[model samples]
Target chain A: MIRALISRIKQGYRTYPFPKKEPVLPERFNGRPVLNHDKCDNCRACEKACPTGAITSQDNKVCIDMGKCLFCGDCTSACPKGVIEFSKDYRLAANIRKDLLVSDKEIKLAQAIDKQSRRIFGRSLKLRQVSAGGCNACEADTNVLTTLTFDLGRFGIQFVASPRHADGILVTGPVTENMRLALKKTYDAIPSPKFVIAVGACAISGGPYIGHTETSNGANGIVPVDLYIPGCPPHPYTILDGLVTFLGRR
Target chain B: MSRQLISIYNNKSTDIGAVPNLPIDDFRETVINSVNTGRRIAAFFGLPHDNDSLKLIIVLADDHQSILHLASTCVKEKYPSLTPDCPQAHWFEREIAEQFGIRPEGHPWLKPIRFHHSYTNNDVWNRSANETILPCVTDFFRVEGSEIHEVAVGPVHAGIIEPGHFRFQCNGENVLHLEISLGYQHRGIERQMTTAPQNRLIHYMETAAGDTTIGHTMAHCYIFEGLASCSAAARAQVLRGIALELERLANHTGDLGALAGDVGYLPTSSFCGRIRGDFLNMTAILCGNRFGRNFMRPGGTAYDIEKSHIDDLRKRLNAALKDVTNAANCLWSTPSVLGRFEDTGILNKQICSQLGIVGPPARACGFDRDCRYNFPSGIFQFKQMPVATWDSGDVFARAYVRWLEIQHSVAFILDLLDSIPAGNIQNKISAMSPCKIAVSLVEGWRGEICHVAVTDNSGKLARYKIVDPSFHNWMGLAVALRNQQISDFPLCNKSFNLSYCGHDL
Candidate 1:
């Protein structure tokens, strides 16, 4: 026991001081993309290059849906005019669906929880996570928050076993057709006044699997979403930041 | 048994016309005889040939000879099943029935693999003609007796894991039988890939099993490159090998930690948990994404390793691996952890080989079935790593094999990082030729990932079949749980770390 303790003590502090101090995101980390309309040639390469229909253009206008973005940086390479470049800014979550679309000057931010929600479940929050049709990347990243490094427990956020104990439903995957009923049942099982947070591009807008008949085009088609965090599988820091932001801690 | 052997080399694509189409019985005998002679089914699926019939294609891998045999036969709505003779084809036969709506008559436990509707109008099970199908609604194997108990756990699990259902028959805490029912996470990946536009194909492959982004992507790229007759750069192959090893390192490290967590060993578990991230972050430094997404482009890699990235990766890998060694060694030394892990969830060599299991779990059972060693491709052809194994065939063996892999993978990556050849990162690939079938097997973190793609007359996909290692190993997990204490299920499960989406796909 002493050896275990001694070994642990020698290892020193492992948790990142995020929100208190800036999160240490690595170099070449794929994050939120920024598009320059002026440089875009309207070639539609990004639309053609994107596996998911996240990039759409009309009348020489270009828009990228964060909810559907995989953050693969395929768009930047496909565009000949250098219209798109992914930035390290990982704050891509939003409360509303329309807020996910980014063009030139529109940068949608996630709004804080309402006063009634804060009053009812302000001190603590519990989540019941379900992966309807995810690739496991989103699930793995979400689970990473519980580790010693991320330590989501310090923020009083816990993933409970059953929906009855959950304050909200944290959903992953593109919500496959087969899982639609189960997603609805899981949502209905949760107590009323509960919110749903869609994590990853799959849960938000089906990610790379948007057009396949198997998916219901993400979590929105089945249930109304309260928060949208985007990435193919959002970085653990990004997920943590999104949770904290939605909780009104930042 | 008297029929002439028809075969093809691994990683080689051949014209579909070159493969002889034997009679149905001949095909069945060929498959059964091959298995009896010690060959494993690499992939077995149906390809839509015409409006009236479908072609049943069988790929058998002879690991000893480093050769793969391919043969096919046309089958109508009903055909004789080979599952009774070759148990390895059990899931594959069920899958053919589910996908092509063909019945493999005479199989003992034949049921819907995914519970999805047939691709064609033909309904194999004759489910009310046009009635809709639901996933996980199936009649499972049951044992009825005094003190008999059944526990059905489902599509929605308590842990933050992929969705799958498992039914267990138990008297007291000992599990008599375990049946895994999946397809909750099925995304119609195969159907989508049949007509997939060239650019979008890699994306589907990358997402086929998200955790296996590198493995699946490599297999898809190999299939396309083989069909298109394009070769990746020498440097690109090395980098791919590096990325593949890195992925194996991250996942194996994580699985070891998870195994420790299941046994409530917090010291090693917590340390490995953090070290796993360090390995993942190293991949992120090489490419733009942590999971190596968009980095494994077809014909080559999407990103190139720079001097800075290589130096940085070396430093992080050395540091992280040192900590990982310390954390993992604690598990072997701790008497309590050893007691819990050893002698639990045992699947001997015979059962493992009979099930056609692959990856570290198979290695734990004293079988040398690693695709990287038996059937070398890409960088594996140029370099080799020793096969890691253990004879115990228990949870401890599984965990030990993973640790062995982690060390080898880290050293392989570090060595490659030092001597990463400088060259072009990508090569242009053309559209595939028509009427040709291609097979690519990748040693994914989970196990052998088999992807078979056949092109139509117009150079479009005629049929695509993916066999994830999890598809074979899930049964191994079930077989291992036989007569095991029900509480040890999690520990056994973590040792395998099978992918639900991969199997469902």
Candidate 2:
């Protein structure tokens, strides 16, 4: 015990200095969805692949409701150009609904082309995750995001335990029937002006498990979603990007 | 104890004097005959088939095993009660009653186990014959004592943990009986999986028991592979084995820490917890998501281990081992911690074997059963890993066994990394004809995780039943809690750390 205390003392202030300096994330960390319009081919694979309908395409233009996207990375894998790749940027904090949505017109096509070579990076944003009938995979990933190496806090992203203090809700799973009440209660508990980011295939169009008469389609079934991150289980980097996009720090 | 044994084989047997045969209609008579012969009832597994019928298979194990199958038609009729003869089938009977709307004719307590009342109709059996929704209800047990004040704790705990309720019948601190009520976290994973298409079933399988993701998914995939006559690639199998072992290591470490924390050993608790965190970080590094999400796909792993990643993992693992070993050594050095845990919450070998407990808890009580070694699958068949066990059957014995297992896990991981062959991480699985039923049994961190899958003619899931280790071990908790002081409850409960969500589903 004495040795442990001594070691802890020596380590000195290991807590991430968030909101000041950008936190360092691991290599494979999945944060948020980044749309590569050049290679997108305007094919709504990502829009169709999304389980929560977080991505909607109209007239060859795609728009991501950042409030609903889960950052599961399904779109990235399904996309032919690797265009919709996961960006390390996780600063997804927003003051209002309009800020979270990313439209095709919002993309600076020329800027996106040049930025492709500049290794994707961003400051960490505080994440508040809700288990809206999730099987707990998304929760597990969100929990791991704060570990030593990933040190999401280092990126200024902190996972506040309470919804009142949260900037966004990182939702996972295909909102199960029993969890519907709990989800509503949690969303209501969180003070408004709070963004909602759906994080897994379950949260996106219910992934492959949609159409279950027993479970909800996704978080949007109960609350308005801002971003859709897609994957059977979204990669950590993708989750980081979604958070950053919400923060407007990307 | 033998009274009468009769075996009659005929094409049609329904009347009282008729022989037991294929077309037997009366299930009550068969059950009565079995009970009259002094045969002890074992277990009953409800197998739901694609034809909308139910296959209730009961086992009577005495000196020999007599398996009885009662195939009920799709007429939605209530079956005769077996609990009157076999008191142990109380939970199973209640579950089957709630799920399939097949009432155990005379079950004294026929409460719903998983589903809520709002979900299913009061006359569920008489309702639409093919209805899938079931009900959920809480049934409290009667407690007897002087001024027996029943205090209910949780559905929401003080700490960050899963939800479960405990009804403690106590006179101040002196406890009379403890009744555990779970299912608060039930998300109806089984019902959701049944509705999912075959190709997408893996998503549901991974979520069935989140912590036991790889274990459950492997079992689910194995069942599908077995039914489809397909095999995962050797590389995929080895990768899965590695992931499973890592899961076991992380959980055991976290549990050990929690156990120590329950005993008020903060130093040991923090140290072990930090080690667990490190392990979780390692998992994140390899799979991109910690707690092992998306690691195991149907035919193989979703992600492959890069050479550099393996090297990084080896480094982290070595450091973690050193730290964890040091922490455990410190814990052993503290005499108070050892004294508090040594003989607390003892479950004797006899009770353990009778209850058919599995995994570390059962191993601690001297029952030598480990699916990894006994029922070898994948690379486990080729590797040499020690199965840790102890006969003490106490809290300390369980902790010691876990400590030993963690060491074994480290060794196994190193071995796997050293011998990992270069190959494709995944393989393509072809479609197969429906009406195929396959069962998969895997040794999870807790115990055996069994998944039974049946596919329809269109290659979609007709029914999927997942039996987590926690379901079988819930009884172990009741037995362990008996006669123990209320103060020792946390220590006993943490020693098991059974997943309420896993069990409820």
Candidate 3:
């Protein structure tokens, strides 16, 4: 018993130092969504794949409503161009709701500028996450971003749990009937000027559960989403890029 | 003679014909004949092939490995029930009765299992026909006694544990009977999975049960692989095996800590909890998720394991495992912890076999059943892994078995990591064909998790059935709880750690 006690004391605090020193994240943490219009065929597969209808095509252009997106990564896998990817950047706090909506034109323009900047130099960004009917996969990846390894916060990105405090709501899962009220409630609760980031295919086009009478596919059915992250559950790095794009840090 | 008769009946099937064209009276006779023949009972799922009436499909698995699909059309007024001979079909029949408003003609117990008082009756059933039913009763199976006193605990507990309710009927120190009520954390996962599209449904599959994410995903993926006849990469299979073993290690560590905590051995409990947390952190480092969610896809894994991640995992595993071993050794040396657990909650070998309990709970009681070792999947078939078993059939035996398995899991993880091959992580398949039904069985932390998936011609999910380990082992808990003292309940309960949400679904 004495030896055990001694051993525990010697172990010396393994807890992550959150809110002080930034926690390290994993290599491919699923944090937020970003779109690469250059590679995109604009098939709107991401929009169709979103569980919540977060992505919508208006006049041959894609628009994302971030408010109702869930980060399940269905859209990432559905994208043939590998255009839609998850970025590890997660600083998605916004003061205005309208700022969350990202159109195809805006994304295309951002990608053009980002390519030129990357050619000259190199830069990355931060991301914010929100969970919608997720089994905690998206949440887990978001949390891993702060571990001792990745230290995503070092890149000026942080995951704020509340929509009010968050820059963008990283959404996951096909919004269930039960979670619909909570999703709407969360959107309503978020202060105006918030950006919605739809992470994972479930949030993009209801990746797997689309066209079922039981649930809604993408965020557009409920709220306007800004970015779409596509993947069954988008990798952390893909999420990071999405956040960086949203923040205009890359 | 009786066994032979049952086997014979289980093997032989008398197919009646197309369900829609069958006469109602002839269908009832077919049902009786099938039940009397002793065919392996399967679930009754509603099929809406016709708009005017719903067809009730009964899947019967014969000993010959052939599945017989028996269907009967039900018009609300004149539906036939078959629960009379097949007592095991009670749950399914009641489910169909409540969900589709199709009255099962002579069911002894026809009560609502999933809906609330507000959403009761035929109209509600017709509106939400495909929604998976959930258990609604706040309190099920209440024990009655005059001045015997009863204690109702949980739905929410003081500790950071999943929610479940425990109702104890006791006379001072001795417990007359203990009733468990669950479903507080019902997220309606199965209902969500049914409507989900083919390409992205794996997310729901991974999260169907948190602790058993790998086990569930593997089972789901296996079903899809078999249905599509798509072979996953060998490297992916080995990696999946590694992830599964890691999951087993984490859950076993947590269970051991919880079991130790139940016995008032705080040192062992704290040590085990810390080790479990470390394992979870290791998982986070490796897969970017503590529960190993999103690590698995239909054909293979989502990402490849990098060398640095592997190195990190090995280092952390070595340190954490050392602590765990030392803590377990100390506990074993101490007599108090052992004395309280050794003979408590004894479930004899015979009782275990009769109830069809699987995994550690069964193995601890000398059943020698394990899906990884016996049923063999992925890397388990190629590798040499030990099956931990104990004949004592007591709580101590159960705890010891878990500890031993944890040791095995750590070793397995190490072996797997050392031998992991470099290759592509995923494969592509694009066949949308009918007659696509596949079943996968994985040994979860608790026991065997069986997932069966049926796909339509359009490659959409026709029906998905997941039988969690808890479903088979819950009855075993009730059997063990018999005649034990009230004080021993916590230890007994902890030994099982059954997921109510998994079972309730």
Whole-model lDDT per candidate: 0.87, 0.64, 0.62
Put down candidate 3 lDDT per residue, A147-183, tens digits, no spaces. Answer: 3334556556666545555444556656644345556
> What is candidate 1's local distance difference test score?
0.87
Comparing candidate 2 with candidate 3, which one achieves the higher TM-score?
A: 2
Tens-digit per-residue lDDT, B385-446, candidate 3? 78899999899888899989988988888888898888898988446346455556678888
> RMSD in angstroms, all models?
1.4, 7.7, 9.2
Ordered from best to worst DockQ, the candidate numbers read 1, 2, 3
The TM-score that candidate 1 achieves is: 0.98
For model 1, how does the per-residue alpha-carbon lDDT over B1-505 read when each residue is reduced to its tens digit?
A: 3244467766678999877788999899888888888899999999888788989899889899988888889999989999888899999989989888899999888899887778888777887646877888879899999899999987888979888999999999999999999998888889988766766778888888989999999998898888898888889999999999999999999998999899998988898888888888888887867788888877898888888888888899999888888888888888999999999999978988888999999999998889899888988887898899998999999999999999999888888877777779899989899989888888988889999989889988988889999999999999999999999999998989999999887
Model 3 CA lDDT for position A239 = 61
User: Residue-wise lDDT of candidate 1 within A1-250, one digit each (tens)?
Assistant: 6667776876568998778888777788877778788887788999988877789996688898888888878788889898888888888888998898888676878987988777666568899999999999889889889988999888888999998998888999999877888889989999988989999988987877877777888998788999999888898888888898888877
- In angstroms and one decimal each, the interface RMSD of every candidate reads 1.2, 4.6, 7.0
Query: iRMS of candidate 2, one decimal?
Result: 4.6
Q: Which candidate is the best by lDDT?
A: 1
Instruction: For all candidates, state DockQ relative to the true structure.
Output: 0.77, 0.21, 0.11
lDDT of 2: 0.64
Error in Å for residue B376 of model 3: 1.5
Q: How far does residue B407 in candidate 1 sit from its true spot (Å)? A: 0.6
